[model samples]
Target: MVTTPLAGPTDRPAPGRRRPVPRRRPSARARRRSAPLTLLTGLVLVYTLLPLVWLVINATKTQDGLFRSRGLGLDRDFALFDNIARTFTYSDGAYTRWLLNTLLYVVVGAGGATLLAALAGYGLAKFDFPGRRAVFAVVLGAVAVPGTALAVPTFLMFSRLGLTNTPWAIIVPSLVSPFGLYLMWTFARDAVPAEMLESARVDGAGELRTFFSVALPLLAPGTVTVLLFNVVATWNNYFLPLIMLKDPDWYPLTLGLDAWNKQAATAGGEAVFNLVITGSLLTIIPLIAVFLLLQRYWQSGLAAGSVKE
Candidate 1:
C-alpha cells in the first residue's frame, strides 16, 4: 500500500489530495440560548415543587412545631400518623363520608360523561344524521361557555325541580362535558379508520355491535383521556357543590376541606391550623392515588396521537 500525507489548504502536493478538517465547536450564542432555557426550566420546577414540599413538612408536625419550627424543617415530635388517625375520626368520621361521596360523584359523573361523550363523538365523527352538523356546532358553542357562568341558572333550574342539596345536582350537570365530547370526536375521527367500520358492517355486524366490538376497542386511548379529564375536573369541583348542597354530609372533599379551613380561621390559632394542614394533606391522597393508578393509561393514550402512517 502507498502511504499519503494529508495536505494543508494551500499545500496541495499531489492530485486529489485533501486537507484534514477540524471539528467545529458550538458557538457561544447557541450555548447561551440552551443554558437560559435549562435554567428557566429548573426555576419553574422549583417553584412548582416548593408548595408540595411545604405541605408534606407541615402535615408531619404537631401544632407547636407548625408554629415554631423553620417552615421546611421536620418536627422534633412527628405527629403525621397521629394526625391522620384524628382526621379520619373527626366529626363522627365525616372525612370518610366526604371521601366516599367524592368517589361516588366522580365515578358516576366522570364515567357517565365519558360514555356519553364517546357516543356523541362517534356519532358526530362517523354517522350522517340530518342535524349532525348543527349538533356539533352547538357542542362547540357549549364548550366556550364556562361552568361558572351556568352555576346560577343551573342552581335555579335544580331548585325548581327540587333537586338542590342532592347528589344529582352535581352528577347530572357533570354528565354534559363539551370538551370531552370534542376530544372524543377528534380522536375517533382520526384514530378509528372508516374502512374498519365499513368492513364490520359488511360482515353483518349491526351498528351497536360495530361500535362495541370494533370502534370502542380502537377508542381506548380517547376514552382514557376523557376519563382522566372528567375525573380531575369532578375531583377539584367546589363551586357547584358549594351552591347546590347545603348539608355537610353531602359535601365532597373540596367543600369539606373549605369548611375545615373556615373553622380553622376562627378557632384558636394552633388547634385549627393543625387540623387544616393535616386535612389538606389527607384530602390530596386520593387525588394522587387516582392519578398514579391511571397514569399508565394516560401515558399510553397520549402516544396514540404521535403515530405515523
Candidate 2:
C-alpha cells in the first residue's frame, strides 16, 4: 500500500479513448500582424459603401427634401414612388424611351460585340495565318488607346458616312471591342485546347461546325466575361452617344440622366433632382442584376485553367 495507491476506477481513462485536443489559439503577435490588414479592408469596404449609401438615402427624398436633408440622411416624405412615376411621365414618357434604348444598345451592341469577339478571338487563337503578330500588336495598341480619344475621330468618321445620329452610330462602334477581342483571344488560347479542335476536325466537322459544336461550350466562361464587359461599356456609353445622337428618343439612360441634371440651367427648365436620383438608382438595378446573375460564371471562367498537371 505504501508503494503506490490503488488506481481508482474514476482515475482510469476510458478504454480506446483519446484525449481531446484543444484548438490552438493565435498568438498575440499573429493577431497584431493581421490588425493593419483587417483595418485597411474595413476602411476600403466603408469607402465603397458610402457613395451607394448616399445614393440610396438621397433617392428616397423629394426635390425640396434633397436640398434640405443631409447628404446621407433620409427624409420622412418617402417620395421614391412619386419620383419614379414623375420620372417616367416627364416629357412624353422620355425615361421609358431611354430605358428601352439602353436595352436595345445592350442587346444589339453588346451582344454583337461578344459574338464578333468570340469569332475573331477563336479564329486568331486556333488558326495559323500570316500577319498574326501584326494583328496582335494592333489589338494591343488599340486597347492601350483611350476610347475618349477616339470619340471625336469616330464621330467625324460616322458623320462623313452618314451613320451619326442613328443607332448604328452607337451599335457599330460598340461591336468593335478591342479589349473584348483581346480577352477572348487569350481565353480561347487556353480554354479550348488544340487537341480538341484537331479531334473535331478528324471527325469531319467543318471549322464553323467544330466551333459551334466542340469549342463553343468550353468558351462559355470567356464569352460571358466579354459579354459583361461589353455590356457595361455600351450601356454606360455617354460621350459617344452624346456626339452621335442628338434626338432625345435615341438617348441612353446615361445621357438622359445627365440631361435631367443639367435641365435647371436651361431657361424655364424646372429642376427634377429627386427624379434624377431615383432614375439613377433605377438605372443601376439592371447592371447589378446582370452582375449577380453572371458573377459565378465569370469566377468559374477565371479558375478554368488554374489547376494543371
Pairs that collide, model 1: none
Q: Which predicted model would earn the best TM-score? A: 2
The TM-scores, one per candidate, come to 0.85, 0.88
In the range 1-309, model 2's lDDT, one tens digit per residue, is 469788899888799998689999999998899989999999999999888888888888999999888888878789878888998999889999999999999999999999999999999998989999999999999999999999999999999999988989999989899999999999888888777788779999999999998777888889999999999998889989999999998999999999999999999998998889899999989999999999877644543563454
Q: What is the C-alpha lDDT of each candidate?
A: 0.87, 0.90
Return the TM-score for candidate 1, rounded to 2 decimals. 0.85
Runs in model 2 lying further than 4 Å from the true structure: 1-26, 299-309
**Where is the poorest 10-residue window by lDDT in model 1?**
298-307
Candidate 2 accuracy as lDDT: 0.90
RMSD of each: 6.0, 5.4
